[model samples]
Structure formats: C-alpha cells, structure tokens
Target chain A: MTSLPTHTEKKLGLAIDLDTCVGCQACVTACKGWNDQGYGAPLSDQDPYGAAPSGAFLNRVHSYEITPDQGAAVIVNFPRSCLHCEDAPCVPVCPTGASYKRVEDGIVLVNEDACIGCGLCAWACPYGAREMDGDVGVMKKCTLCVDRIYNEHLPEEDRVPACVRTCPTGARHFGDFADPDSTVSQLAKQRGGYDLMPDLGTRPTNKYLPPRRKDAPDMSAPLAPLLDIQATGFAGWLDKVLGKI
Target chain B: MHPAPSVIVFTVLSGMGFGLLAFLGAGLPAPSGWAAFFHWGLGYSLAVGGLLASTFHLGNPQRFLRAFTQWRSSWLSREAIASVACLLALAPVALSNWLGFGWPRALGLIGAVLALATIFCTAMIYAQLKTIPRWNHWTTPALFVAFAGAGGAILAGQSGAGAVMSALLLALLLAAFRIGDGAFAARAQTLGTATGLGTIGPVQGTVRVFEQPHTSPNYLMREMIYLVARKHVQKLRSVTLIGAGIAPALLLPLTPPSLLGFAVIALVHLTGAFAARWLFFAQAEHVVGLYYGQR
Candidate 1:
C-alpha cells in the first residue's frame, strides 16, 4: 500500500469580501514592495520614466462599471492574483521540479536554483498568476509571503501575508480552510463566497464574496425646475449658441 | 503554453528519432553492414538525447521516478512511462545486433511499438490540455503521428530503397493532414464569440489594453499569444509542404538507386518538419489569452 501523510491534509486559504473592498490598491503596492525586497531579485523596470514602462507585480486591480436598470452606478473593482490552489496546475507541469506545491502547507513555490528559465509553469497556469522575472530568467508568483507567515519574530496579528495585512478595508482574511471554525471559513459560509473560474477545476483556495446591493433609490420622481439658462454672462452666450434651455 | 525550447527540441528530435526507428522496424528493408548499424545507432541516440534534454525541464530530477506513478490522470506521466519502455525495448535490439547473437527482428518490433506509443503519449500531453483549445483538438495527435512518419521517411530515404516509398507516402499524408487542419481551424469562429460578448460579428469597440490585470506580463499572455500573422503562416506552410513533403516525394522517384536519393529526402524532410513543428506551437491559441483583453 502507498503511504501518504495524513497530517498534511489541512489547507490554508483566503476569503476576499468584494462588498467591503474600497479598491484602494494598497494591497497591490504592498505586495510589490514586499516581494521586490524578499526571496527573488527586485522587480526591475526597463524604463522608469519612459513611454513604454513595464515591470513585474504580483497583484492588480481591475475596475468594471455595471449599470443596472433600477439602481445607481455600481462600480466593481476586482483585485486579481494567484489563488494558491489545492491542485495547482502550474506546479507539476514544470519540466524542472522548480515549480512544486508544498505537501506540508499547500503553498506552491518555485525553486529558482533548479529553474532553467524554461517558462513552462507560466504556460500551465490559467489564472495568469506566474510571471517570468526577466532579470533572473526564473518564474515568480505570490509566495503568500511564506517567509513572514512562519517567522517567529513577528506577532500573531502581523503574521499573515503582506497583502492581507496591508488591506485597509478588512476585505481580505486568511486562515486554515480545513478548520471549520476559522474566520475565513465562517465568513465564506455566511456570505456565500465563490471561486473565480470554478469551471477550470483548479480548486483554488481563495474565494470572492459577490457584490451585494441594498434597496434601489426611486428614479421615477419628478425632477425639480431647471437652473436659469442665462445665470452667468458666458453660460448665457454658450447656452444660446448650443440651443440649451 | 510558454513552449519551452528544451521541450520543443526534445519532442521534435525524438519525434524524428523514434519515428525513424519505428518505420524501419515496421518491416521496411534494413541497410546491410556498418551503414545499417550507424542508422539505428544514430536514431536511438537522438531519441535518448531528446529524452535526457526533457529532464532539464523538471524541477526535482531525483523525484522523476515519481512521474510514472500518475499515468492514470496525467499524459505527461504516461509519456515518461512509455519513453522508458521504448528505451528498455531498444536495449535488447542493440545488444543482439552488437553481440552477433541473431537478427533481433522481434526485439526491433517491440522497440518500434514502444516508440510509437511514446510518440502518441507525447502528442496526448498537448491534446489533453483543455486550456489550449487549438491544441486540444484531434488534429494535435494526427499532427504528431504525421510528423513522426515524415521524419522516419526522411531517415529511410537517406539509408536505402527500403524506406523511400514509405517515407514519401508518410510525408504526403502529413502534408495533407496539416493543410486540412490549418484550414479548418482558421474557419472555426467558436473562440470569437465564446466569451458571451455577442455573435461572430466584427469587433466594434476600440479594443485597446486600457489596464492590465498586472503591471508585469503574466504567464497567460506569454504562453497563448500565438503571435504569428496569416501571411507568415502561409509562407511557412508552403515552405514546409515543399521541403518536408513535395521535395521528398519528387526526390524519392528521381535519384539513382543507392542511398543518394534517401539522403537528400531525409535532409529536406528534417528541416521541413522542424519548420512545421515550430509553426504548430507558434499558431496555437489558449483560452486564457481572452482574459488578457486580446481578441
């Protein structure tokens, strides 16, 4: 019989509350700042002040405008990054064992020393999570701030990932998903959180809470009288020329 | 998706190597004396070299033994297992020939079967990746088989008459299959409207990259760009068709008896097939690229 470790079955994950998120992009900046300083080489840019400036970043925010017929403008801001899946497609596809999921903590990591800059892991990922560091020629992604999470020097509150810690709106929460009583698990259950692209079957550990809306404001009410057309000297001439009341 | 060069080289080289071996072992006439020995030796060496090169793509070389365990779910695992089997089968054939024990036809046949199986497994690795719709189709495996046959024919043409006709036939079949598949893929507009934006209408918006998901270029963009233009593809296809297919066909019937015709055919086929394989990877598109704001 094949023997496998039962103790390593527990997986930690993240719960992101979309309703509470203010889209500050604080987490994005924090993640870039931390990752650039730790583990791999710094995220270098080709031209810091040029027309076509480009560099590496682990997290990014996507803004979308959702216009419903009965409600005010609902702007949805989605922060995208690696989900740190239970079945990470990027890990095993690595021809070099440089990309691997830790059997202990379920963290997917790339061993830069073993990597030949082949860039196969990046191809395997559906999330667009992994990025090739041009300077180092090795692949890199969100480590979930592995070094800080396990460091004994840090306090319990500050032990989470830099992105989670830096989130100003308390939208991001991280904990062991295997433990039912964990805050992330409880929040997910109460809020009906969902994984992005669940059809891919990656079994991503991170979950996103659907955007919720309160009662819509009444738009059918009669409008107040319009402002005077000739209130200002420049406005009177412009309104007359433009044929506005 | 990133089309790692080592992997591309490994698949292309081994496809030719094992392909030639299998074709020879499939009852094609064997060259006599040192010529026969050199042909078999070189083909096997190329196959083994390709396999070894693939190991560089792995992160933990020591744990490679574990790859064979996941054959049930992973095509990659199946490929590893099949490659090992092919190598094992080649051992006896090589041994018998070197020791002057016997004809070793039975061992050769076994090696050939394993080699074909390995090529199939390698093709399935790409065919099975659902993320890449272009590669996931039936054409992928057909392309693999065709390329292998084409490569084998080239080798046979180089060695002697035993292979000339067979190589010519395989090259013709591969050329036809690739051209047909490319045309079919070009016509399929399933990818254009799958995102639920609308029907297969012309793009109306000024679809520029307003803001990317990340500041850095991610894996999705790098792997699935499939950046080749239609004009370049047409040119490459014509070149491959002539060099890998047509030239080999014409050369097989024209050259004087001996190995001269075979050598010319083999050289043309190898170069042509390499170009074809490069185009194969360069033209394949991934579904994830749609998310990168690419049409």
Candidate 2:
C-alpha cells in the first residue's frame, strides 16, 4: 500500500487564501470538534485546565509579524495543515501499510488498525502535518473530513470539510483540483496560487493564495507644512476648523 | 530529532553483531566446540537483543509483526528482512562449527554479504530521509559500515594485523564523516521557501514568531525541535572521536594480542560508536523545524 498509484483520478484538496484569513483559529477548533466524535480517535488533550495544556488538532494557524525596513509592515496569519501531496513522502516511509494515499479522491489517510505507530511518517513529512496520538498509539492527520464529506445524511452544502465550513472569512476552499473549470482551480489560476516548499517535489495538492501588497502613500515627496510657527495659536485653530468644514 | 535511547542501543549493539558476523563469514577461523558455541551466542545476543530493543521505540510494539510486510518500499522493512536472512544463514554455519564440522565456505560467504547488506539497509533508513539535511548523505552509510566493521573485527578476535587495519580505517572514516557532515549544506528548503514568502521579498524580513498556536510543547515540538547545547555537542563529539577512533586505533595496536585486550578495545570502541550515533540524531535538522522558526 505504500507503493503509490500511478495517478489518482481526482485530486481533492484545499486552496487557502492568505490575504483574507483573520487568524481567529475557528477552523482549528471546528476540526477538533468534528474529528473528536466522528471518524477515528478523539483529539485528546492532557491537563486541559492545568498550567501546561497541549492537544492534538489537524490544523493550526501561525501568525508572523513582518516589519520591513523600507516597505509597509505586514502581518500574515498562516494556517498549517496537511497539503495531502500527490507524492506524499509520509506514505513510502511507513513500515506498516498504515499510511496510504486514496486512489479514488487522492485523499491521504492513515489506517489505524494496521499502524504500528512508529512515527516515521511524521519524520518524513516536510510539513508538520501528522501527529502521533499517544492515547491510541496511532498517527492522526487531517482526513479532509472523509466521514462528513461523503455522508448522504448531511445537507448538500454541509458536505465540505469541517475546517472549510467553519472558516469565518471564507479563506478556505475545498474542491476537486483535477477539474480545470472547478471553482478551486479557477481561483488558483486567477490569484496566482502556489504550493508550499515546491522544491521538495512532494507536489502538494493544497494551494496557497499569496497576500497582496497594499499601496501606501509616498513619503519621498516634500511634505506640506502642517502649520506656520509664526502663526498665532488662534489663527492656527481657525485654519484647522475651516479646513475641516 | 531526539536521540531516543532504544534507537541508540539498537544501532550500536546491532552494528557490532553484524560486524562480527561479517568477519566470521569472511573465514575468521571457527573456534572448536564450546568456544564456537560461546562465539555464536555472543553474536546472536548482541544482534537479536539490539533488534528487540528497537521495538521499544514504537508506540504500538505489539503490532511490530506487520512491519516486515512492507519490504517493497520501506527501508525499515528491508532492514528487517536483511537482518533475519543474515541470522538464518549464519545460524547453520555456527551450529555446524559447534558440532566440529564447519559449513561450506560458500554459505558463510553468503551470510557475510547479507550481514553487510543489513547494516547498509539500516543506514539507508536514515539516509533516505530528505527532511533531515544532515542525515541525507552517502557518508552516513559509509560511517555505519566502517563502525560496524571496526567493532566486528575487535569483537571477533581478528588477528592483530587485521584489528590494527580496522582501527585505522575507523579513524579515517570517522574523520571523513565529520568533515563531510560539516561541509554539506542544506540546498533544498528554508523558511522562505517553505512559506512561499521568498517570492514576495527577502524571507529574512518576514522571520518573526508573533504567536504560537499552543502554550505547551506539542508532539511536533517534542519529537522534531530537540535542542542540544553547543557546548555539550562539542564535548560529546570529542568523546566520540577519542573513544571510538583514536583510543581504539592506538590502544588496539599497542596492547598485547589477547582476548582481554580485544575485549577492552571493543568496549572502548562501542562507547565512541554510541556517542557518534547520538550526535547523528541530535544534529540532524528537520525541514519541519523551519515552520516553527527553529531554523
């Protein structure tokens, strides 16, 4: 099972927009809530109310504050998850046939029953996507909401991943990337969507929309004098009031 | 990468075991009767015991039997297969030698080749990982082979001349491994490349951790973001070089050619090998560490 298929028919993945994300972490919580009770094991936490609390979740949002010397300051909220790569490195490294890529939808999944929980797949991944569930002794990752996405009981609109549905700013999009005319594919082409660590050749299925630069007012030009030092306080106040009116 | 105790024990002990088997298979004179039994017992104890120790590292040790089935793709599985084959082939030879009638030379030759192949497979498990910049190199397996050969020569009571040659080779390989490991640069990916922010401007400009997603250490941080202090690392490197390389090279040559001398040299060399293996895991910088700004 570690030997990858020649090609999967459909590449179902997420396209995240960096420009619109607010770093609210709603998607992270939603993913935990859904996966905890659904599909596999619960996203268990140790000492939740104690001083040191840690829990395993499929998604995490990292905030980077970029203060450039000359350009405008940019704050980027990067949400990290499994890109579900076409040539997933995690799959081949697994000793047991636990880590596998789906032939149907191209969704990479871990077979908990077959896993020996060696943690080699985690070491193989360039992205910090896979987490070893200590409670159950198996690797856990983003299933792309495999349970809910295919369930007939769910509403048509609710068939998407929990993370995608929970995104407040609509930053996350889930669709079949194989379809050239699909909304996800079109958005990727239009916004110049790019892959993370393209050099590694994992060929990640998820695409990230680069943050657009905002045009700032030019500071190079000579500034107009705010107020003449020679002018009286009363005159300056009157000028400011007249300018506002 | 954390220097897990089980892995360290497995690599060092198993390396010696395979090394002894390789020398034995290469026609190191098979001792008569009880001596042959004792020799075979020692080799199996080291090799099989080390292999068993490695299972402790797995989260689900009971499910380890399934690991042998993925030999088609997984290096770990290949290592398992090679190791089992080496043991099986060597066992009959050892048994025949114990009964005072050694097996044919061809069978011993096959076992020797398999023993070396087992070590190579074990090294490949680490070397094949593109994620770790330090371990992804040809020199890693070479080091493994050299260490195993040197340890095996000493453990098997090889002739004084052979032991001296192995010690010298070990020294050269250790030096080469150190230099190569130091000189190699990580050309694959950086924080800028990982985030796709390098396309916009300099990635260095955007390298700041505003906030972490979790307050406490998560599994990723514990497993991947291990940090060994520079001072400690330097000290350990010196210890490894002296214990595994210089001391063995010098002491093995100078000491009287006796079982006790060989035993002393073996013990000293193993200490160095252990230190070296620890450094192997500790210094390896995983690409995922870049995501956490640890790079």
Compare the candidates by DockQ and give the number of the best one: 2
lDDT of 1 by residue, B29-68 (tens): 4655566688778778778888888877653455566556
**Which portions of model 2 miss their true places by more than 4 Å?**
A221-245, B159-185, B201-205
Q: If candidate 1 were superposed on the true structure by all CA atoms, what would the RMSD be?
A: 7.0
Computed on C-alphas against the true complex, the DockQ of each candidate is 0.14, 0.60
Model 1 chain B is weakest, by summed lDDT over 10 consecutive residues, at: B196-205
DockQ, computed on Cα atoms, for candidate 2: 0.60
Checking candidate 2 for backbone clashes, the offending pairs are none
